[model samples]
Each structure stands twice: as structure tokens, then as C-alpha cells.
Target: MHRSRKADAPRADRVGRAGSGALALLAIAATLAGCQRGSSETPTVPTTGPGGCPAVRAAAQAAVAQAERTDTAWDGPTTGPAAVSGRTVVFVAETMTNPGVAGVANGLREAARVVGWDLRVIDGAGSPAGIQAAMSEAVTLRPSGIVIGGFDPGSTAQQVADAAAAGIPLVGWHAVVAPGPSSRPPLFTNVTTRVEDVAGISAQWIIAHSGGRAGVVVFTDASVPFARTKSDLITAKLATCAGVRLLAYENIPIPDASSRTPREIASLLARFPDTWTHSVAINDLYFADAAPAFRAAGRKGTGPPFNIGAGDGDPSAFQRINSGQYQAATVPEPLTQQGWQIVDEFNRAFSHRPASGYVAPTHVSTAANSAGATTWDPPGYREAYRRIWGR
Candidate 1:
């Protein structure tokens, strides 16, 4: 998080600026609280050419077109030690309710079975204390390895240290800021697409789809550093388009998303009735929660407030995209393939080899190319991993 620098000013001027800032904050708070009434008119989309930034629009269109391609080949690791058989593993989930976490866990289970390893999963129930307790239990179980699934490892520092002290190799799925081996948190490797690519392409999608003239709202979970970072990058990219207006930056935690999103969406509809042209969420679940609110507010399923999830393209996201119900696109991670990668990373550890350091490339999925699929299951990864493991 970079902070903007301010020049020195007089005390009186500073006090005046502080007072204005407070008023602005109160106004925003009132809008979010559903106290401010908004217009009932739907936002009008502009059929314009890159909003006067032709070069940016052209680059965005090219990138989005490339990302939407469905014929990407397997580019992950193809060589390593064969499976380390008969080992037991445990996956400590941030919350099974998060489709991303659960999806990866399922992939891990499938790969584990193929590699002939026993696997156990413990649900953290999406609480700090619950995750800590889960981590503690995983360390005590003394499994061959422990997976930090979709939660910050720093939050459970003691448990992670205990696992490391016990010589248990730790692998993470969206666990740390960066992918591939971390020294501070002690992860053998982290499985995730590069956050910058995901964020950049997501924003570019909005630019290309809207012809660089979108009034965008970005939703993110501030509690998770990774989610927050992605949202920030998305905001930065959206700023590149001169005609795109950032209507709002909503911070709704993932666990609370199901409960809070409906009210938030209703409020946003009232507040920015004609200006909120598009939305980009860090996860797709927000749109699922916002569906009823949108319907109640008389917003069409195929909308002016077209939504796109920046990451975690789960089955539900695909359904919404395929049906043209609120969501228009997603930058989906190869969840199942990542799960297989986790197991493969563990095998490398067991074989006394280095982490694969493989980060999946970013891809965007939309109605035109989705082909009625439920998830973005790219081809060749399963077979490639199988051959690498000699299964």
C-alpha cells in the first residue's frame, strides 16, 4: 500500500481541509447507510471509441481477446520426482464456504488419490480463532505436510512455526503475498496466478467491453491482504482510462458477503442509480448475493451494472456468466490444476527437490467463449501432472 505525500500547509488551512474531509466522509457514510436517496433511472451505456484514449483501448482489447482464448496448452512443470506414496496430508481451509478454497481442496483430494496419499481436511469456519485452532490441530496431527488454504499464515504464526519446527513442509494456496517459496512464513511454494496479471486483465476487460467509458464500482475484502492488493491494482488500472469513473470502492468481507451484499447493492443502486455502469469484485460470490437485490430494484439480469469477478472463477460465476445474469466475465484461476500442483510440490519436498515455482497464467472467461461450462477446467494439466508423477 503506497501512501500519497502531502506538502506542508498552514494550520488554519489544514484545519479547514480536515473539516471538509470529515464532511465528505459523513456524506459517504450516509450513502452507504442507505440514508441518501438516489435516482431510480438506470445507467445508460455509451457506445464510444475508447473515450479519447485509442491506444489504451486497443491494447486492452487485444489483451482481453488473447486472455479469452480457450485453447491454451499445458505450460506448467512437466518433470519432477514421482509420487511420494503412502504419505498423509492435511488441508486447513479458511472456510469451505468460499468456493475457491473448497474447489482447490477438491482438486487436492483428487490428485492425492491418484498419487496414493491419505488426505484430511479441516474447516476453519472463516474465523481467526477457528483458523488458529485448525492450524494447531494440523500441527499436532503431524501429517506429512500442511496446507495453508486461503488464509494469511502470519495470523497463525505460532502454529506455522510449530509445523516448521517439526520439519513439516508447508505449502500454501493463496497463503502469502507472493507465489513460490516464502522465507518469513516458511512455505515450500504458493499456488496462485500472479495477482498483478489478474488485476490488470480484469480492469482491462471492463475497459475493452465498455469501450473505455465505464462508471465502475470495485468490491473487495479488506481483511485479506491478497484480496485488498488485487482491488488496489484494479483501481489503478481503471484510472488509466480517461473516461471511466470510479463510482465507489466497497470493502465487504467474504464471510460477511452473503449477509451484507444484498443491502449494499440496494444502497448502491439508490446512491448511484445512473452512474454505476459496471462492477469488479475480488470474488464472484458478491454478485450471487447481489442478485436478489438487483431483481428487487428492477435491474435487468443483463445489465448496465455489468459485473466481473477479478479472481476465483468458481462454478456459480460461470453459471451467472453463461446465463447473462448480472456477471459478464471472470479471471478464473485453474483451481483443480492448482490443487494438483500442491500435491506435486509436496512430492518434490519428499524427494528432496526444490519447489516447482510455477505460477499459472491469467485467463479471462466470458459468455462468448465459456461454451456453457461450469468451471474453467483448462486442458492437459491433469494428464501432464499424472505423467510427471508417473501415475
Candidate 2:
């Protein structure tokens, strides 16, 4: 679900099964706006009970309500070419190699093809200036619509507002506009997992597995909102688990693409001699170093060694989980689903019976199913999507 208010700010691991086309249909009905509740309030989900779908429905409603309240934009007047179907759709992102994000780009392309619309892609390499330049270039083409992944809204609010001003719908794919009180114009449409939701889920998992007894040493790439949000959420949630203690939640200052694993691992081993049962990670990207170090130091498994981790389902994370090198991980459906969902909404926005909003929640994948898993699969609505775009 989606919402309309904005606020303050912050901060994945794992894998799960591929979804079917019916997912899109289910989302449309389950995620109508106005159902989401406040961030702090977690609805009573059936922790242990039968017919849990009702509880799940309540939770889903709360999630949708939260999204609507948080990312509400001005609902600007419809813009763009009178005929949206033939207009080109362009997707812009921070980079293509980011596993979660790449899935989104692929989804948008596939959706575009399904709808018979033209598609173009641009990579910004995580550079603010590069992304700005890319957005500027994208606007010049006057495409029917645009989708963005992982660009900070505070920095690009004006550019996005300008796109909307031009009458082109600006849709946020995987990343929602930042959502603190200070966040800029909320994204028009987004497929996001609220930071708290991700953190709460992780904390619940950790606490359950560790019997509320665990120690933590966190590594965060402060640049990503989702990462920062997750970190903040974990810090708060862990405080409640009396048995769980956070040893350190500091940022690791590693240059982009730098190999800081050995140094980080060495520091962790040296600094936290007692060993933690779990080391929380924000994404698979950071595991390049953290995972190996945990294994090398003999910190993994059912007991003794701390469980190593790779946050999101980066391919390596899947491998690490399957091999028992890491304990567990969270894998959302590829960002492609986000892309496809946003496009589906965009298409509806063109029609009079457009949907008010929607949410695409993620699934968690563990070691048992992580072996040989692939994150990039076409949406289940491939045929329907293709029917709209064409073969």
C-alpha cells in the first residue's frame, strides 16, 4: 500500500521463490491505499495459529497504509503525450550491477516490450553528478514516462518535479523517495519496503533464532537510504531483545569497489574477541569482505562461530548460504518486479479507472533454497505484459 505524508530518515539479506503473474493481480486488490497504519504500530500477525491469512491481510493493510501516508505526492494533473502507449519509456538507475536494482531495470524493459512501448536504459554509476546528467538527458527525449532507481530524492527532487512538471509521470522503482519530515516531494508511485518493516522482520528473525541472545557488529554503506534505514531499525529493535546486544554499528569507510574485507574482518576479530552469534548486514554488496572473515575466524554455524551474513540475494550471498558459510539472508523479488509494478500503475494512470496505489512486498530465501538460485526472472504476467507491449 502507499501513503501521503513524509518525514524523517535513517537506514536485506536472503532469497525466496519466484512469483507468478497472479501476483500483480493480487497486489492490485490487496494494496489499495488508506489501509496502511503508522510506522510504530505493528498489527497482530498470527505468530502461531491456523487460518493466518486474516492476520496477514491485516499486516498487508497496515503496510499499504504506511506507504500511502509516507510517499504521498501532489497527485499532479495528468501529463505527457495524449497517447501514452506509443511514447518511449526510459529507466535510469545508479548502476546495473547492483543485483536488486538490475532486476528492476530488466522488469521495466520486459514490461515495455509487453506493452509495445520503446525502452531506453541509463546507468549513473552511483555518482550524483552522473545521475543528474542522466536525468537531464532523459527529460530532453520527452519520453512518455520515466522510472528511477536508488537516486536520492533530496538531491534530485527538483529534477523529478520538473519531469512531472513536463507532464511525464515520474515513477520510483525499487527506491522510494526518502521519507523523513524533511524528505522532498514524495514519489508519485513507488514499490518500496519501508525501512522499519525490513528491520523489524530481521530483528524478529534474529531474536527468534538466537532465543533473544546475540551480539552484533554492523557494517553499513551510509550512502544508501535503504541501508541506513535498516541500520536504524535494527538499532532500535535490538534494544528490545534483552538477550541481544549490539557491540558496534559503525560505518565502514571503504571506497567504491575497494576491497576492505580483509581489514574489516581483521578488525572485527580483534575488536570483538568474545564473538557474536549474528552479524547484521544491510546488503549483499558489503558481504564481499565480511562473510569470508567470519568463516576464516571460525565464527559461523549452529554454535560457537558467529553466523556470517550477506544481506540481500546477491548471487554470492545465495552461494554462501547454500554452503553453510552464512546463516540466512533476505531476498526480495528482483527489482524487476518493482519496475513492472510501477509500469503497470503508470499504464493504469492513463486510464480513467486507475488504481490509487499499490505495494509489492518481498519474500525471504534461506540456505536450503539458495543453492543455484537466480534473481533475474521475468514477471509472472509475462504473457499479459507482452500482450500489452507485444512479442
TM-score for all predictions? 0.87, 0.70
Q: Which ranges of candidate 1 are over 4 A from the true structure? A: 1-50
Per-residue C-alpha lDDT of model 1 across residues 203-265, encoded as one tens digit per residue: 899999888888888787755556656665676677667777777778776666778889889
Worst ten in a row by lDDT for model 2: 10-19
- CA lDDT of each candidate? 0.80, 0.52
Q: Write the per-residue lDDT of candidate 2 for residues 283-335, one digit (tens) a residue.
A: 65566556566667776533332343323455666666556665455534445
User: Considering only N, C-alpha and C atoms within 3 Å, which residue pairs clash in candidate 1?
Assistant: none
TM-score of 2: 0.70
Q: For every candidate structure, what is the RMSD over all alpha carbons to the true structure, in angstroms?
A: 8.8, 11.5
